[model samples]
Target: MDKTTTAAPSAAALAAGRRAGWLRELRETFTLAWPLVIAQVAQNALITTDVIMMGWLGPKQLAAGTLASTFIMPFLVGAVGLISAIAPLVAQARGARNIRAVRRIVRQGFWATIILSALLIPLILQVKPIFLFLGQNPETTMLAEQYIQIGVAMFIPGLAVVVLRSMLSAFNTTRIILVLTLAAVVVNAIGDYLLMFGVFGLPRLELRGAAIATVVTNLFMFVVFLAYVLNHKRFRRFHILWNFWKPDWHHLAQIFRIGTPIGMTVLAEVGLFTAAALLMGLIGTNEIAAHAIAMQSASMAFMVPLGLGVACTVRVGYAYGRGDDEGVRKAGWTALGLSTAFMTVSCITFILGAPLIVTIFLDPDRAANTDALRLGASYLVVAGLFQLVDGAQVVAAHALRGLSDTKVPMLVAIVSYWFIGLPIAYVMGFTFNLQGVGIWLGLAAGLAFAAIVLVIRFAMRERLGLLRRTL
Candidate 1:
């Protein structure tokens, strides 16, 4: 009543209201972004940490790690993309209030992953000869083979973590991925410290030690995730482990049917990079070293958008699960918008600071790379321009998977990354003599095409009411 005394509701009120807004936005963003962000950052940090640790071992270790990661990618790639099947499937079951279905799906995913890992384990040995055939320097190949042989042993349990974690994510346990990934990263760091320097009375395995560190961390994460799932009330009450033991051949077939296209497409894209590494080797170590530096820098950038991509999948799946057609459309747009916004800043950072970034991974004094730095900067700058579309396409494609339309998007990715991207890069880098930048330009064109086509697919699916309907 004493109007002068009201005093604009005091400074504390303003601060509290501001804090409230921040909290609300954070909660929403967390719901939409945290799991995805953490997942991406953890993975990027893992590789970055690995690089930093392995750098201590020698340049040869760096080369070995690079070669090993690219080679086993195909085996891992198929499993990675295919595992997304569990998220949307479980999301749908959650939406339907079908606890039994969720349990069954989770069980089937484990079954699928185990089978795939078993098949891939044997292929790991073939990696050595394959690298030699690809013209890897004999020294690099020798160290790379050591890493591949020991590192891949983790695949058995690793696949289970991938599948099961995804299954839980489908149920809205998205935070688990970040939590588990963080745990794994810590474990790996300790293992690396112990194994790399002969800490704790352990033998110094060098590159092989790094590989073992990763495998051991993966194993620890698998057990942690499995224990959580098995002990959870929802899973236990439904007898998820006991009753959902048998495979649902039909659903399994459905997963392969829906998943294969996207899986293969992703495989093809990663395969291109692997082949590019090999081709760079043919140009000489100076070029490959520069190329590796650029690639690693981009890989770090790739993680941010990758996290966005995973978020897109979750948002799209959640919308589809709820039979919210408009929500699906909006979610797709929002995820892409988020990716574009994030990557736009990233693109600028890389293009402007490419040289500085490369320097972190390379010892400039001993580099012996005549024009690798210049060429690497140019390659990354151009590659940076395409980062937006690269992320957008990945998000859109995963959204399409939420719409249960993986086949078309898969085809689009395969054609764009392989038939279009690789060929262009090959010709530009060789035929046109554009060299390093040429390869990246090829990558740009492919990402651009993919972004456009996948967006169109997402739009078309939305218009047809596909998002609200089940397969």
Candidate 2:
């Protein structure tokens, strides 16, 4: 007897299965991402708090602090990327249950952080001469130098926090990292109040107070995180403390090979923004202050997508380690979706609240700040327009990094920012007289370009099943 022919599954069934997969991926990514997002915001609080307190001092201080930070941030961010070599390694190790590899990666992360921090000191010391050579206002440049000098004191500890966070993020131990960063925030805020205003009879250090507060907060975070990682029973199995100082040249070299590109990519993006800030300095102090205010707000919003990117790296890295190509695709795409959704909301918020948001960093009642307030509000509009594209590119880049495909993304960033973005910024700001708005438009276009290219790259890599390829 012939059996009844079975019907193939309908399109509706296939669509339903796809929807279920997306829902499952989104839920998993959200679980991994939210705590990480909070941790990032809290960590940024260390800087945001400094900027806010500096704002209270007056416009000149704000401008000076902003300029100094622009120069120093590239170095700090690049160092973080160098240390980021730990994330994928630790994630993959955990996935494979290779405790020994995890320990070795952590130890080498420490070594990398030290080497990078030492290399940054000479650059930090020359800030005064460099800014002077750039024709910055002598008073403003000197103030900037003062702040950066104090800030350099915290580099090692700050990088230690980064390395420790990378490892914890891979293990999805973000909640603990969140708690520690929050404590650092509180300490930083209280310290800023005490030192900046001379509250409780402490010296009124003004901008220097902001720098000192940041340094203290860095130390607090590093010590607490180190203690937990070393003593906590959950980390005990890895024996991270045993031979912690042991030198491992091969692994360290491997880290640099993987890390240098990541570091350069970060520098490329940060350098563009920092270059914009410096260009604003040439326009006038008012413009510089306004740019700082608008950029600060944009940066706060950016932490959400930035954290999602980190989560994507860990999730995709874990899946890669396990040889789960499908898992890698799901993790990357879910992260992209989440970042897009969040940036949409943020963009809308920035547009609607431009006036109110810019005022937060300035003293609204002060007539002296009227120009800065007006200029800052307008700049926020530009900031709002770019949020979606900015989020897309950053998340896409991180997704590729997770798949160990950073070299191409680095090239994409260089071309997008240097060859395209900065040239437009210069032409518009000067030749076309768009000023600050023109510079910001260039940033938006560059991010859009990078986003399109990097997203396509990730798609192709997935299709080709190259997610397992490491540097």
Q: Superposing all C-alpha atoms, what RMSD in Å does each candidate have to the true structure? A: 6.0, 1.9
Q: Please write out the lDDT profile of model 2 over residues 3-43, one tens digit for every residue.
A: 32333445567789989987888887888889889988887
- Cα lDDT tens digits for candidate 1, 1-471: 666567557766887986775455335534856676777688667767777676556556766777788888777878878866887777666766666677677777777777788777898888778878766788889888888888988777877887777776666666778887887788888888888778878898888888888888888988988888778875556455665567689778766776677678788788888877777777765566667677777777777767766666766777677776655666677667777888899899988898887667656676454365666777778878988888888888877877777877778878898899899989999999887778878888888898999888787884665655653
Compute the lDDT of residue 464 as modeled in candidate 1: 61
TM-scores of all candidate predictions against the true structure:
0.89, 0.96
TM-score (C-alpha, index-matched) for candidate 2: 0.96
Candidate 2, run of 10 with poorest lDDT: 1-10
Backbone clash numbers for all candidates listed: 0, 0
TM-score of 1: 0.89
User: Candidate 1, which segments miss by more than 4 Å at Cα?
Assistant: 1-30, 199-201, 243-245, 365-375, 463-465
Q: Which structure among the candidates has the greatest TM-score? A: 2
User: How well does candidate 2 match the true structure, expressed as C-alpha RMSD?
Assistant: 1.9
